[model samples]
Target: MHFHGTEVRQQALTLLRGGSENAEVARRLNVPLGTISYWKHVDRAKRGEPVATRPSLLCPLCHRRPLDDSAYAYLLGLYLGDGHISHYAKHHVPSLAITLDDGWPGIQDQAETALRAVFPHNATCRVRTKGAHNIKVYFKHLPCLFPQHGPGKKHDRKIALEPWQQEIVDAHPWDFVRGLIHSDGCRITNWTTRLVRGERKRYEYPRYFFTNKSDDIRELFTDTLDKLGITWTHCTRNGNPFNISVARKASVALMDTHIGPKY
Candidate 1:
């Protein structure tokens, strides 16, 4: 929800300096209008071009204290997998919420840890909804945390990382992958039967599988795998919902080393 990255600040400055109106720039960039106005004031002050009162540009989460790269990357993956950002028109409040099955207390704890790491100033609360627990972070700039947000299911919309987000994910690929797997993937032992010289044999092996309806999300998962030298395959069951499987023994071992089994 906070804009801490230098890249995002630079982009806002460029757009404002190019004569884009504040509201239009904010709409186009999906940033809060206050954020764009704050940057514009900063630019004018720097150029001695002058004017109104100087409002503080410091964001509590982003400026006073910032999230570490690892935490941010993990949270990003979790959001992409099972999170959503909501804006209420009446109250004009934006919140980032990650929903997890109520059964997985460990996963809920991990998500809480990541959220707390990002917003130490704010308390992370868990609300029960239906059969899931929702971890919510209320902030004005929630969209900044998830620039890929749009209307409807993720698969029906395009998902792409901003430059700053890409840098964060690139630096902490393992953590990102761990978050993705923790949210939507699993490590399990699969068994199959084979006939060997008129005898039947059963063997068990460990493999990892991740399923997501979004093509872009799937691609992001596989791209991270490729970067980490992990091998994976695209698979389909029945007719819908794509999956990626890391079934090769060596690859599975490598993933185990990095992601292990979720606690």
Candidate 2:
């Protein structure tokens, strides 16, 4: 459903002022996330409105919010390290910078005090306390850097589609504006008996998509993508699904060759 121009601007402004998740809000509003961000920022500037902070991240005592990425990064680093770094900073790193030669005992106390003030008191602080060397090793060598910082935590986790899903998305015709490939239409065939191995029987689901227009969708897609600063390409034989299937091009392409752009 297309939105009226004024309605679109109003929704965008609400999302911007509220710091709502752009993608979810856009999906809910049936507008592209890029368009939402663009209109939100633009409308705010046009109104000479002061950008406001989402209250969730503000310090309870001061009501101050993070002003820069570095500050957020520092908070994230600290959160990842848990109270371990803070503990070490308080008890061991007596000569550490910031808190002077005595270390950050007061700062550590204030942070803990600040956290309890913000989060539920029943939620215990379970930050693992360890020496600096061990903490450093964990961050550098761990496959998942911010393991505990998931979708529910104070940070937003990156959502990555599975390899096959990525392949389908990559293979999607680029010129289309508002088309969607079906979630469950894809299928994969045999060649697997002697080609690959697992301990026992293998069961899997590989998917394909429905047929749709290319260029018209591409115009809409391009408009949204330009606003969002994204770029994409037509699928090539090198794409994972293309490599797996017997067909050189996507089956969807076969159904409607006119829908796709030249690679």
Candidate 3:
């Protein structure tokens, strides 16, 4: 009597609790000799059950799982490419192995505990359900993605730019200079909406990119430095717009403050 996948799984589990030996379970269930062994661990548990049923595994950031480390690293690359952390957690699920929100309180607790280890000091860390047997933990800021404290102040600071002010900079004579201070460099200069009292607070993120070779780039860099704003810089060698000098400036901007608005 050949058993199907579902029957084999049930019999193997029954054998586990019934104290049946692997061979005995195989013989009694009339499955392959290695069937029990294979199915025994096929499922990775999010809580108490196995993870194989879902088939698709994804990370908490992107709603896809890696078939291998190469795939995982590819997802991480997308994360570095301007992917918002909150959006990642909100959308992605890790490996489908078992998310924190699998409706298993114990599993959710375990996942939360793991995240807490990474974000020991972050109070806003929490988990949400992604899909069947999938859960993702949400972390708001990019700098807080990893467990350890990042480069600068915890608080995300903002620069007040008038609507026309950014345009004026965008029209700068030098292409390099324009690139440096243009809207491209400033990702979040404007707010989604105005911040009013007794309502939710708004955060603004502004970044600048520069290269060292061009005179205009250098001038833009220096001018940005004089303004004392949050920025990250990368060089041709690094391939990031915010290079070492810009990082130093960015670090300075975040000094002496925790992230987010002060209560």
Candidate 4:
């Protein structure tokens, strides 16, 4: 929660020494911007740089991770699919929110758990809006979890993984795939009517489908599948959003083993 006086000062100093901007430090620590400015001014004076003369008292100082695998990978996948990172100019806060169907409490719990795993310091809260529930994590910056964030729709923007992110994905591709499918994809049994020996017969089969508007995101899904040796088919639907279908029994079995059916 809340940091005070000496603790705040120490944390601010640590961040400042690490070359974090004053505004960033202020936002991250939830301290007043002016406080960071004052600390910076004091530091400058000690460094023999140009500084305004202010009351300098020897006030006591005090003290103060990423989603990579498992829960983190799952969270990342959920974010890439249903979560959104937004910046509020008025409050100067950057927040990440993931909305899930309130009807499914288990899914909401999973989302909250994943968010907590990825951002242990931040508080994860659930809010109900209309018929849906949202699990939100707020912080000072967006890059902490959503490095792929940029201007415009995710589909319209380019999405690429950093080397570290790639490494995580490479190590836990199954979890990553599970997250993606749990958020944006679905597994269902479909029934078809066919003629067998001149008689009408109904057959049922299982299939998994993932849909998104971003080509890059679609590629990421398929590429991950390729690495896992799972078969999938990509096709454009309505000449806008695209979809990937995993219908073969073996592929479906593999996905079931890794991702399973989202509850």
Separately for all candidates shown, the number of backbone clashes (residues 3 or more apart, or on different chains) is 0, 7, 24, 1
What would the per-residue lDDT of candidate 4 be over residues 177-237, giving only the tens digit for each residue?
Answer: 8778877888889789999999999999999999987788888889999999999997555
TM for every model, in the order presented, reads 0.74, 0.18, 0.18, 0.72
lDDT of each: 0.83, 0.35, 0.38, 0.78
RMSD of each: 12.0, 24.6, 18.6, 9.6
Candidate number of the best TM-score: 1
lDDT of 3 at 206: 37
Candidate 1 residue-wise lDDT, 39-71, digit = tens: 888789889996574222224345443557798
Name the regions of candidate 1 deviating beyond 4 angstroms: 1-65, 89-91
Worst ten in a row by lDDT for model 1 = 53-62
lDDT of 2 by residue, 1-263 (tens): 45558866686667667878778778877888778776766677778977564343243224533323222222222333231222243333111111111132433443334333323212223233342111121121111222332333221333333343223334432311112211111233323323345455554422232221223322333343344333333433333332112123343344234223211
Give Cα distance to truth, residue 12, candidate 4, Å. 18
Model 3 superposed RMSD (Cα): 18.6
Off by over 4 Å in 4: 1-68, 235-241
lDDT for each residue of candidate 3 in 115-159, tens digit (9 for 90 to 100): 344334333334343532332334333232222222332223222
Candidate 2 clashing pairs? 175-218, 176-217, 176-218, 177-217, 177-218, 186-207, 186-208
